[model samples]
Target: MLTDLPIRKIIHIDMDAFYASVEQMDNPDLKGKPIAVGGGGKRGVISAASYEARKFGVKSAMSGNLAAKLCPDLIFVKTNFDRYIEISKKIRKIFFDYTDLVEPLSLDEAYLDVTKNKKGNPSASKIAEEIRARILNEIGLTASAGISINKFIAKVASDYNKPNGQKTVNPEEVIAFLEQLDIRKFYGVGKVTAEKMYQKGIFTGLDLKQKSIDYLDKHFGKSGHYYYHVVRGIHNSEVKPNRIRKSLAAERTFSENLSSEVFMLEKLEQIANEVSRRLNKSKVAGKTVTLKIKYSDFTLQTRSKTLPYFISDRNILLETAKDLLFQETLNNSVRLLGISISNLNIELSKKSEQKSVSVQLKFEF
Candidate 1:
């Protein structure tokens, strides 16, 4: 089974404070200044903060009120997702030039399987350098990259050098790299899982490697199987290109809290229509429809209903969203409304997909 697994060269590219960086590049006055991209009101949450703002404890998802207290001079710039999306497409184009085996985690980060690249470059390190350099030269932005044998290590190494740097973990150094990594730093280990591992004396990768698979299975259940191999630098997940989007959604925050269910239903209708339009444009339908509601007190609630058949009809989506909205009693006045559809069938027409793609040669582990 081990010999059947493939050995791959993976590179993870991540933009540093992407939104904030974009803001700085557009407005020279904001350069080197502490800034955040998001609403900066009493109830607003930050979407991203510049490196300068980070020193003041301002971070993404932090409440605007708290961020203000952390840094009095923190400038809050409203998020321009349209602009960000445009920039992201350009970056993806650059990745495609090197290899089509690229998986975007978000607009700011992606994983590339560059073992066999279009440039025929044997060195993955050199490819990463060229990619980063092109981004800086053409796009006027900086990116950091990590190179390794798998996704997990590549992701972790990408964070080792921030702002503008890259790290490569050679095949021979994989074991030592994993052994010395902190448990908290390992991918998939969240706060609760980290605390649980620390309680069990599993503070580092080495400590985690010492546990028997059966012992870990007893304590951690299904995740035990994953940790058992990750600790030994063994991850066989493939870099899937053109990954299907799981869901599509549209949401809007009201300037004032709404009290009437009739007004709320009207908002849901518009949101559902937008979601329907997006679904059709993508040529995908979903079985699950989710309604997300945010109350005036900043509390959020989500309700979903799965249909027996896939649908992209506006009427069906609006009716379903209305049902989900009225199914539960309003605990408080609503401040935001959103509608999303998931469990998508994203198989596109054969003619739409690009042809003559180069296939990467697989290597036995």
Candidate 2:
């Protein structure tokens, strides 16, 4: 461990095939079956798949037709966001029992800072074990976890033993653990980026560490610096709680591209309504509105404006998106559009406001 950097006790929790597992739990007929949670028709995308389906390489974001071809008996269940959100809230309540420094990555995953928790637990490993057990006992769902000195390592370690398991990277093991890890397993290194790293002779974390910071910066740009530090187990991103929502957003991907402003307006209004609804659900309003455009060629662009006061009305959101939409001409036909509101009015609690992270390297997380 680097003496200069602070040691934190972070845990990343990920639900095992969350959507598919929920389907199995709710409908016993789907139990122990190869299930894909999403549409099965043409133009359908698999949102999630069960471990049973995973044996045949069926996975999330896979084309429905291809998934069927791979697993002939794959059962498709419709996506149920309402049920998923309801279950997610229950899981979050469980987290608060130990600590309030819970940062939810999504409905199925979160990062919790257990360095100083309500339970006064010293062992993050035990905390993780108990949390997983409680989820299985109380909610009837299995969750996996990783405990380590920081969020990046915790996130990576969570996948070591999956489907209701946990791994802890002790303070002494952090460096060696990272060195042996495959570059492909690194959180931010996707297929394309991994290929780029491979071309630079960076197949593992050890290989990544061998390169000079300058060399990595030349090849990977801004992310080069990120790769340089994280391989040394030095990611310092904190587990910001739910009270700190930076923005509220809603987006939709179109089956057909919108070729003109006239066609785009109809879809933009719908997205604005969703953004407005989410803001109200959180009981917050924003002063800035941003219009995100994804062109048919897959390029992304955004136009934003800050308002004089916060607003959450759908009409106000629609009008703001409209103004930004007309601010610039289309570079290409848009295949996706989104509306986001930022600079929120989510006042932090006094207790949360007073909280701060402090580190002690001797603690066994």
Candidate 3:
């Protein structure tokens, strides 16, 4: 029997080529150029490539040498994580003005539940449009948005319209939309999985839905249940506001690999600033500070220190990060540097505590 479910409203917002876009927004010289933000060494990887760079087959995670080969004229830029986090905070604040039910996936993307929004607007589509416009107006960066009845469809819909576009999928249109979508576009299906599905003759949602639960389970394991419902447009995930944060981190791959301590320290300071900003924004304090370094051989190493007290201060974080970096000996030229805050505290107010107690007593009576 088909269960009647209450209509939900979800929005997914994704920033296009986030790091590259931020660099372009800050420097007019970089605008309209094929830009790649990453290490330019033999083993260095591309962190983020601009849309122009993508046109030439450059992509994130691609080896820096291959990226340069793909687009010889590609301009590489050092990542400025501090600037990106600042912009992310402004964007998050814009989302909070509409609904508190915001779940950040990364610095560039998030899911928002606006089923019962502060705006009192009946249409989620209108709210998404307004949010996109506000982001452009306030942050000077373009963002694409998707509005739908659930997270699955909303995330897919957001990508339908590229760079500064909005797309919406109403509940009624869900099935037809999924029917035509490529198997690769499905959320959990990566390149390897899609290739496997193709070998099994499962090319579309209909093909996937036609397979028996037993058959799917035999192939995909426990995630088969998720695939079964997703193909049928039966997602029931909720927008949880009180999400526990597992990790907070900021990392940057340089435009050029460096062996110099002076140059590395400059970049480390910026990463530390970003990590601090993110911790402050989430109202989290971390007891551990970790430093990650990736060498030109693609080898990675990490050093971490747990502090006596939880901290979110920029200077303290930077100093700790600097110390960790100094302790490590650079075997090969360093390509990437990262700082992460591990332990977190979800802050609640003492004043709100008394109010909550009073409300509970009133309800009891």
Better of 1 and 3 by TM-score: 1
Model 1 bad stretches (over 4 Å)? 1-5, 253-260, 294-300, 331-336, 347-365
What candidate 2 gets wrong by more than 4 Å, as runs, is 255-260, 294-310, 323-335, 343-362
lDDT per residue as tens, model 2, 1-365: 25445657899999999999998999999999999998466657889999999999999989798999999999999999899999999999999999999999999999999989999988999999999999999999999999998899999999999989999998778889999999999999999999998887889999999998999899989998999999998776767785478999988877778889999888998999889888988889999999999898989999999999999999999999999999979999998899999999877545523233454546666
Q: Rank the candidates by TM-score, best first.
A: 1, 2, 3
Candidate 2 CA-lDDT value = 0.90
List model 1 lDDT by residue over 235-299, tens digit each: 77778887768899999888679998898877888888899999999999999999999998889
lDDT of 2 at 249: 92
Supply candidate 2's per-residue lDDT for 319.
95
TM-score of each: 0.88, 0.86, 0.72
**How well is each residue in 83-120 modelled by candidate 3, as lDDT tens digits?**
89999999999999999999998899999999889999
Model 3 alpha-carbon drift over 4 Å, by segment: 1-3, 247-365
Note the clash tally of each candidate: 0, 0, 0
Cα deviation at 331, candidate 1, in Å, is: 4.3
Q: Model 2 Cα displacement at 71 (Å)?
A: 3.0
CA-lDDT, candidates in order: 0.89, 0.90, 0.85
Candidate 2 residue 310 C-alpha distance from true site, Å: 4.1
Instruction: Give RMSD to native, each candidate.
Output: 4.7, 3.5, 8.3
